[model samples]
Target chain A: GESVGLHLPTLSVQEGDNSIINCAYSNSASDYFIWYKQESGKGPQFIIDIRSNMDKRQGQRVTVLLNKTVKHLSLQIAATQPGDSAVYFCAVHNSNSGYALNFGKGTSLLVTP
Target chain B: DVKVTQSSRYLVKRTGEKVFLECVQDMDHENMFWYRQDPGLGLRLIYFSYDVKMKEKGDIPEGYSVSREKKERFSLILESASTNQTSMYLCASSLFSGAGELFFGEGSRLTVL
Candidate 1:
């Protein structure tokens, strides 16, 4: 399978270690944010989301933190496994673009045993 | 499970050829989007539709058009394919609310010669 993010930033973590991925947006008015995971040869899969009103949201083994003050978002994964290896993308909803979601250049996460 | 189905997984066309990419969502989402993904560039929106028979241009809508004749279906059309248009095309659907998370298809990889 062809890799998704060949030239984007990369993070390598050993199995069982926690991983954090960060994203920054230029729009402070962006009220919605989402995290997506895309494996090789597949489209992005929704992992989690957070609204501007909330600072943090957690899912099973995954946590999404939103810092509206700085227009930053981060995804934290606990107990990382090899299956978690993929390209992760952060999407922001831009009201100026008629509420279309704009995606960031993905971060390639490689979980090694 | 919510499924967004893309009609073609891979396609090859020559310059000046007409190309059509079909997307269907089983979740009956109100908003559907077409985006092209390239290495290091993330995903760029081509077009989107929030309702049947209605369309909106995204940040990068040139050379692309879309149709949403039915609630569950959205189509991306390239009037005349170009080599620069060759990329991994992704289709996604979300609820009407601007804050809703997007669900994406497996994607259609198109190559224009």
Candidate 2:
């Protein structure tokens, strides 16, 4: 069965600290991966994406790393802030399924002062 | 900014009632999707359309149907709303096919009594 899953259900971090969220996928055919951030009552927003052709991709304050060898993907947030507290999800796109995304259970990040 | 707009931000319905959720995208995307977000469970894809009038079933398509009458509009129909069907419904769009970054609209929180 092809599925995407997160390593942890929740993460607590202090302000100004770096945060890392992990995701694992079962589909080897997956070539494109994306990270999304969702606020309390909002939809998922794109943060960063990494293709299988590249090991890493970086956005303004976020970085996404793709390790095809282990079928792992990770999102790293630099200097986590209160505004960064949200649920983060990782999605995978396989060539076999055009336009369909397999999303992992989200990790809720809580940044405290 | 890429805009995906959902028709309703919140909705309340009774069991056995038919419900409709509409989504529109301004990016001239070829793909549109509907997903439901629930507690503990991640985003589950209900349905997606790669092109107008071409709909496909996603992982969790039971109890839901989709319509893509036009390129910019996609609609999710719940044949009979149930208490178990209450969830946060998200709509998304992507420019082309597989591996494209998805742009999501603010979700519509539906409550079925």
Candidate 3:
């Protein structure tokens, strides 16, 4: 079955270090992608989003990069902090009009202070 | 700031029991969705509503049903709960279509015994 997957199931980083999370999607028709962070006992929170038309989009301390040719996506976070520890998920928006997102298995990010 | 709130943070149900999860959004979003997240499988969509009284079955809606009596409220129902139905359920809302990042509530953790 077609699916989206994260390269790593868990990541550990030190405070003040940069962190990178990768995702690979199977559907070529996916036109939009989003990154979400889920803390303990909380729902997924929106971090950043990017459309297929553009290659990269930057937020406060995060950046989303998309590679349509490889069907890959990545999220880069600058200055890892304790508050950044959470499960990060990558979601893709289908090209069809159903307005649903396909999500990947989350990657647990642990920031060590 | 937009907020999505769930009625419960934790719920416990016995086998064959019916369960309901409620979600409300302060923002007048046209699109509301329900999802269940599990380890390895990630977040699977249960159901979604684009408007009041309109619902669509998502990827995994076999043992579940949904209701959207009002534009700001979406509810997920488990016709008969089972052990395998235990998971963290999340509710999210967004604007019409897939134009914006989704706003999510604190998830409801369901434990089916």
Runs in model 1 deviating more than 4 A are A1-8
Q: In terms of lDDT, which candidate is stronger, 1 or 2? A: 2
Candidate 1 per-residue lDDT over residues B1-113, each given as its tens digit: 88999999999999999999999999978999999999988998888888999998876899998889999999999999999999999999988556778889999999999
lDDT of each: 0.88, 0.92, 0.91
Which pairs of residues clash in candidate 2, taking residues 3 or more apart in a chain or in different chains? Answer: none
Q: By descending TM-score, how would the candidates be arranged? A: 2, 3, 1
lDDT, model 3, position B75:
96
Instruction: Classify candidate 1 by CAPRI docking class.
Output: medium
CAPRI accuracy category, model 2? high
Question: Chain A TM-score per candidate?
Answer: 0.91, 0.96, 0.95
lDDT of model 1 at position B25 = 98
Q: TM per model?
A: 0.94, 0.97, 0.96
| Better candidate by lDDT, 1 or 3 | 3
Residue B73 miss distance in model 1 (angstroms): 1.3
Top candidate when judged by lDDT against the true structure: 2
